[model samples]
Target: MSLSAASRPELDDTLAIRRRTLTLGLLTLTYFFSYMDRQILAILVELIKADLKLSDTQMGMLGGLAFALFYAILGIPVARLADRANRRNIIAVSLALWSVMTALCGLAQNFVQLLLARIGVGVGEAGSSPPSHSIIADLYPVEKRASAMAIYSLGVVLGGGFGTMIGGWLASQYGWRVAIIAIGVPGILLAVLVRLFVVEPKRGLSDAARVADSSRMPSIWSAFADMWRNAAARHLVLAVTLTSMIGYATSYWGPSYLQRSLGFSVGQVALIVAPIAAIIGTVSGVGGGRVADWAAKRWGIHAQSWMVGLLKCAALPFTILFFTTDVPAVAITAYVFNMLFANSYLGPTFAMLQGLAPLRTRAMWAAITLLVINLVGLGLGPTMIGVLSDALTPLVGKEESLRWALVVAVSATPWAIFHYWRAGVMLKRQQEMAA
Candidate 1:
């Protein structure tokens, strides 16, 4: 019962487009709340620092490594479950698990308690992306997949935006505890919506030739070997992970920087910068996906990959320039451009990874991609910046030290650009041969 083009309607057809839209919307909504629970801590950083009497390094650990450890470690196993069982069910359960953990964050009495709660949130969140990626790949053909994923990736923007705005408002009036609790509550209802409505797309619906190779259902180790053997996959993973490191660091610390360096209060930063960043993120995210799709068709094989690499290289200068500025207007302006290129990478990267992987192992590879992303990006990126900020605090004072640390963190962008370029070349070679 393989679905070929004859049996499966064309992507542009009305029915197919509607179903794809519905599926992407639901999954994106789940991702939105997921990020809300995960990233709310960024807006609440100073408050938590004061309440817990914690250092920057400790806060970084809570935000980065502590949560990432469980998230990266558990992600592989959960992805395995996603590969074998119901992906929609996995999404539903994960949503509920993380939402509850997020709510528990409100009840934390001490730093350790809050750290533990964040870990629970990470563990719960581990189940999310892989299956969703797998589902999107199934629903959309290769030509349209990147755009669909881009729309889905809007969760990051919307979640981060709403999370910052609402988190700041709540922290101002109700306290950080209530802020944490309020955001976590809506997710329980979203989880139920996913369970009730989001259909579990039959695996490999768009590409049956790849799926017919039943031997692809090997052990997780076998998939790891497969990935290692894939030069494009290897480069793509490294590129995406390196970029994510910078993205995560910027995302978690951007509010802090605006407050400390630019002299905005938490409320001011959230109200002004957060919404602006979100709007930029939303536009750039969808625009990036469309650009990738257009590049692939207009340029040649793997042109989408090249587009991503080029965009990253192009953005590095602006990122460095952003940190050097003292004026809020100049910095915010620079950040908009930086994020325009920066945010574009995820949708294309996810689509590329899923397209390159064997059909059955799509979810597992997605998990592995995220594992590295969470482990290296989420784990080290913030912590490194935090540690650097602390070490330089005595030399430059607190605010200036933060600015310097972010400058150094932005240096990683060049490395990401290099990997993306290499991935583009490798992906081009593979696609050319396949054709």
Candidate 2:
């Protein structure tokens, strides 16, 4: 029996929902591994440093700038392809590329080789998130988008946690190389699964008829222009970049701080800090998304208000408490809250950007925003602290240099809050224009 056109639309809608769920789930899992590979170095920093006979600056370059530089610079072109081409294929291929590169990191015999391998990993990872964001925007309606994105952002916490726990255990038992290989290999199989199982959904499938238009797709340059015109997008990207500087600085250096100040071994530091930070970060990341949603619904305010306001209020005290406290238990408690608060911005900010970007340009816009965030945040944050640490070493000693560097880094958090607030105001204006 042939179905009527009306019946066909309904059938298509049902199928789209199922496909979207499958696609999002697979993408999120893939992201989890990507994050794990990126962060495993944090847990194994001391071992890698000693084995390679490297300085703090060199380790910072490997973990922070080397990967981030390529990742940031290459993201735009890849995202342009993702915006116009087959995003599912882009993501699958990207997963495979990064996975292989990660495994190659295990084979690196020297600092240069490892650095080059990491650059490869960065190139591959540059392809994952922007396409995933665009695809997810296609799947969910505007109102529910933040919550959906939040769920996906949980990969960050899961990846970091697993990397620390698993990477640490492997390094402790075997070696760092084995840890790298173990984490890298699973992504290959997962990449195959992604290509086989995930189907792309129609762009703007969940939006109102007025907002969905196949012919409205813009060029990559046009997409960037659109983002520039949207004040909310501009402010959101700036705020996210600034806050990310603080967050990256802390996450990258916190392990070393613990090792120096608390005198924890590599294995012990992994056991204590990794699980605690992971649990707190994951819970807060997810909870932040929900809170933003809740706040938006209950008050007639933009979700950015809830996001930015929370950050501003929490930044100063958390910074002061975290750096100044000498007690490990107190420090950990402070660090947990800091991680939670810092990560809270992830879901709301991304959701806002996705909303502002034209449907056809979602991936490109997301990629551009990521480029800025990583270049400024990941690329510079840790390196800045390392520079500060090195410069202050003679005056304050190595340990105190790190401590003072953190204190200086935390100052960026307030700047992030201001941008977020500006984004909130712009969001209101954009909403009115859309209306």
lDDT: which candidate is best?
1
C-alpha root-mean-square deviation, candidate 2: 2.3
Which lDDT tens digits does candidate 2 get at residues 1-435?
466865876676677688877877898898899889887788777788889898878778887899899998899999988877888899999999999999999999899999999999999999999999988888888777887888788788889887888998899999989999999999999999999887777778777753654685677678778888878788888888887787778778877777876667778777887898778888887888788777767653465565655665675687678787888888878877777776777777888888777777888899999999899898898888888888889998976888888889986676777787888887777667777
Each model's TM-score?
0.95, 0.94
Candidate 1 lDDT over residue span 128-149, tens digit each? 9889998899889888889988
lDDT of 1 at 53: 91
Off by over 4 Å in 1: 1-18
